[model samples]
Target: MAKVDAPAVEERQKGILGWIEKTGNKLPDPVIIFAYLIGILIVVSVITDWMGVSVEHPVRVNEDGSPVVEPARMLFRSELIEHLLVRMPTIFTSFHPLGYVLVVMLGAGVAERAGLFGTAMRAAVRNAPRFLLTPAVALVAMLANLAADAAYVVLIPLAGVIYAAAGRHPIAGITAAFAGVSGGFSANLFPGQLDALLFGITEAAVGSLVTDWVMNIAGNWYFIAVMTIFYLPVIWFVTDGIIEKRLGKWTGGAVAGSSDADDDPDAPLTAGQKKGLAHAGLAVLAVVFLWLFLTVDLVELVSFGAVSVWGGNPPLLNPDPALEVTQQLIPFFTSLVAGFLILFLAAGVAYGMAAGTIKTHRDTVEMMAGGMKDMGYYLVLAFAAAYFVEMFNLSNLGIISAVNGANAIQQSGLPLPIVLGLIVLFAGVLNLFVGSASAKWAFMAPILVPMLMLLGISPEMATAAYRVGDSATNIITPLMVYFPLVLVFARRWVPDFGIGSLTAAMLPYSIWLLITGIIMTIAWVYLGLPLGPGAEVGYTLPGAN
Candidate 1:
């Protein structure tokens, strides 16, 4: 790849892209925006509280069988001040994505600094055809979510490097991967952590109405698998045809923190780098084997004095019959973040040693430190975002708004298919304010699942619809936990890339995805397709058929 001045790449903004970019960039910095949102939330909470605004809690009911009402609470009280002042540290620390990014970067930093990532990218993509790059990244990004939030940190930036190596726009690469990882979040080939979480909530929500309803984590399996198939081309087209054209070209030099010595894509790997890659390869295999070993039943050992039995299904593969299948894999699913940290850390160390990048322990420490240093901006942004999210939850506005929306849909008396489509739209709209998929579902499932069931729409169908809406809007929402992290990634390539820029770039993916997802969902229902194993798109309540 040829390195040129960053400014050599022309900005060709036009049409909707130009308008969105112009309008979005007009906003203040992300931190200030969050602060403003916090103020607005407080005012909304006070007004809603004053007006006695409340909604009937869908799942929780009184002993007399009346729905429990949840009233909005004022956030301007003395208690609010104390919570903010006293719990400031905890609030920042407890932000879930904070630990995820920091831990993963600790390992990823060493990998990049030691030239492991750059070398690997060159070695992997050198012989590959350039045309297939976007689809490959899109596929991997969707599947990579099995590692949970680690994918956001690990894959998105790597996509940029991979694109740069192929002589394509790095920001375009980031856009495609971001869209797949987030906007196509629900569209994985197999069930993973999200399946377990959302389905667990679905099971509970339907339990009151249907006593024997067992949660099938794979309820949306076929639907999501099809989603994967459909989303691949959408991401590919948008990245190759739309985003790349808008991005113009990649005349920029190597990304910061990368080894310029090894930046050329066509350059042959040195003997030392080759040896290092082999070592890193071995390290990755070992990590994979270790994780796999922990997922199966081991030999039973006789207890003798100081010895205990090793025989049993490991925690990673729970043998407990009482839990659902996905529930059983919870331990393993949750362990993926740690698995990735260890994986990257081990590979980087092995590569660094074999490739002559790390001569001393201090070198490795410095690499990790460098990685953390890069995260400085993200840490500040996360602080403001964490407080805003927590305060929104405490104010009861998010849940109340979701419940009221569901109530409105139920009362619309629209056709069942149209109502289902509305559920998708509602979920997508609600996602802007409540970014957590499980959080929004917990509030929604209670109302949607049972309500839809009464209308002869299966809980699986309702869950599937929610998945569509939840995923489609993720890339467009700054409130999404990883949105700032992605913005940080984009700025590494294009310093001018702002919150508005990202939102505008991702707006196309969001719109098309929601449209396609809604269409697929409604069509599946109309055709009476099976959602998954023993999961149908339509339901017949007991004694009604």
Candidate 2:
């Protein structure tokens, strides 16, 4: 294969990218797209329901002992209409990421509004050496997945600010941060809620075939650690070498200045500001210690009383000697979003008090409210997205498509590696529509997991492959919940930046990450490397002939 110069490739692709930008920008806003999707889903559901399109349930059994299959249900009918109209409020409220985002923002808003977040981020970036700035931001963004959405909310914008402050193209910083946060999403050094969620489905899939099989949530721990290391340079090279060069220089007006220091980028940190930072640091440590005391088993004897007061031992992560440290702290891992809430809350309060940003208790409360206020558009978008997703599920279109896709692959006489690559590619295509990784996996696992196991691939490998595809396409997809939000962040710096511009900027990351992920997946499979702590690249379904 001929090596393509980044600049030449970018130049050659300009026409196509410009077309995408023109077309995408001309389309309605994300919320409108979702609302339109809801309508389309209703129409399609009626058509499919009338046409009697359906698929046999992959894992479920019927009461009469036959396979339980799902058929398309019309969303326009009386029952479905009643659910949509009457329970509309509940539909929005029960959206999975809604609560997480709201809870986290209650704290993040305080920090951001109180000026704690900006000061801290600026200080951190200002102190970093020139050469390490790009990689440092990328690495931090990769690890920021532990904070879930906060990474996108905080790090991506800060990256642009940092890069602009350092005299580079601010968009490059945004791209790098986004690449790590979204593109390398699953490639973390540690497992968190994502591990638990996907592996739970993996467990159910395994149980369908191997009755006695057990799942360790840390199944992809080692693989992701290696993936993180492998991806670091990819982001580094792309950001510093390719992206920055292509963008030329930072002539996009003044960088976003400090929110609190009279809009000055180089304003000296006041004595009060320094003190606030120190107090914020201490607050972070205190919150960490508090969570550790409550969650870690070693302190159960002394802290059990306090832990019980807060509703006591979590269901997933109790002191089970048989579990890995990560598995044992499943409760902690899952509660990270809330943990971040308290973390930012306390730190923000401490910093605000010392920095005089919070002159009164009412000020702190107002800041928290301000955070939610910032999320107003997000709430509206989520409501539409939630209904669309729920309706799609109700229509059974997602599953039917997934099953048919899997069946097609199973019947093809393709090589195993090639089949897996196609699966990854298919997932990338599907991700353009379904942004929720877990939701897509929930529908696909029953088919892909079992199908791959029969083909000598492990559920861990299947999940891993799914993750690679899911993450690689995230940056480019408009339907992704945070995609518009990230664009909002970008527009703050460059007022003219549109969804198309954001999509075009992110396309490079998506392509390179997808290529790297495919190579990594194939290499890992060919070498037969362990996918996780106790998981292998191959599986033997119990009693399979």
Candidate 3:
């Protein structure tokens, strides 16, 4: 009887895992997650509305203008319009934002397609000392995200080759890069498209609870940068200690795709690409210098619907005269553009020097066009994601759930640090199954951000907490879209290493990072340092009380 029950239990476990895998993928997807999560919110909202949760909205009477703040009963299913699903289709479709992201992705795709980015990674690896390989790879991978997809297709694979050549496991190389790039998704010295979109979502959420709420892109910058510092050392230790130790030793020959330290006879980097690197680097440095000079001098980049270099708080950060809070976070807001510009400038110059095609001014323009062509699929994904979010918003379901859930959390006796830790852990566990950062954020942000706001935690603080959880367990989760890719890279050294094998190797890192992160959050709360500009370490009203 015992033996028979054991087999049955095993089968049940397997069944559970299968179900989990299916749900995980659907949950982190923009199209699916937004739909499901938002649907839940709407359903919950209706229930709560039925139970008598109401807010008396204040608005001034106007003859011609629609009142700004109208009474909003938490929407109920019955409250939904008859054309609801019909109306939802257009809203969902509208969510796919293709333009702004593409403007940046096109340039990114060009550099990546031109082999400039490939050359850059190889070049960095070849030049870097062995001891520094872990740190360098981690740092570069985190920074390379500024170029969008460049890190995924380019840096990840290249990492395996570089490590294999350096007498280490190729899989370990991929893991390190993957860890830094995807796991460190929220950690960037410079923000990118993701930042802009998230801030927009946050701004909208804030407005729902406050009048003229401003959520600048840079609202979470300082926290992100600090988190980067928090993450780097942890990653370095994991790569150097566990991964490399497991691989044993590197054989003499280079791996398949490596640029070959001795110079590849097939497709070599040209002097032009080298020159491009020099130029790109210079351009990036110049931009950095200019920014520092301006910021330190208190020059305003955006201010009160105007651009002014010399002024007060609202300089370049706050472009809306009506939204003053944005000014406090301008650097975070504009960094995405800065990130794109830097990647293009660097890759463009590098490509120009290596390919020699960029020697003249015309070649550069063509390179820009070339970049656009490579961005074809990414544009599609972006559009789909946009539609997903927009659809969820129009439903107003996510808002309802967030309000109720946040209200529940606010009423609970949980400590503030406890809340942060739990969110991080939730993100970590969910991350293992789902593996889509933005999708998770989209589903979570509507509820988590507002909920935390009710707890007197700033959205920036909530964003930071979400980031920590989402990134820490990335390596161990088989569900991460990039997880299998890392495994394939790992298999180069340990031929039999499969999903279980990879997870075992990476589990220690994931666990330790989580522990450390929890510790850090507690320390941060105790210190009472601001998470960002005016972002409190404790609870406060979502808006003016």
Arrange candidates, best lDDT first. Answer: 1, 2, 3
Model 1: lowest-lDDT 10 consecutive positions: 1-10
Candidate 3, residue 176: Cα displacement in angstroms equals 2.2
Ranking according to TM-score, highest score first:
3, 2, 1
lDDT of 2 by residue, 1-545 (tens): 12222222243224655554345446666667667767777788889899999987665667787877788788777877788788889877766556666777788788778877656655655556668987787777877675565677777877777677778788888889899999898989976557755765565555434556555556788888988998889898988888888878887654563473433435667899899999999998999888776764444557755545335554445667787764566565556667767988999999999999999999999988888887787677666666766676666776666567657666887767777787788888777766777657755676677678767788889999999999998988766778767776676676666666777778888888889888888888888998875678887655445
Find the candidate with the highest TM-score and give its number: 3
**Backbone clashes in model 1, listed as residue pairs:** none
Model 1 superposed RMSD (Cα): 8.0
* Candidates 2 and 3 compared by lDDT, better number: 2
Q: What would you estimate as the lDDT of candidate 3?
A: 0.63
- lDDT (CA) for every model shown? 0.76, 0.74, 0.63
TM-score per prediction, in order, is 0.64, 0.68, 0.76
State each candidate's clash count: 0, 2, 27
What stretches of model 1 exceed 4 Å from their correct place?
1-15, 61-67, 129-264, 300-313, 317-319, 413-545
Clashes of 3: 27
Q: lDDT score, residue 465, model 1? A: 95
Worst 10 residues of 2 by lDDT: 1-10
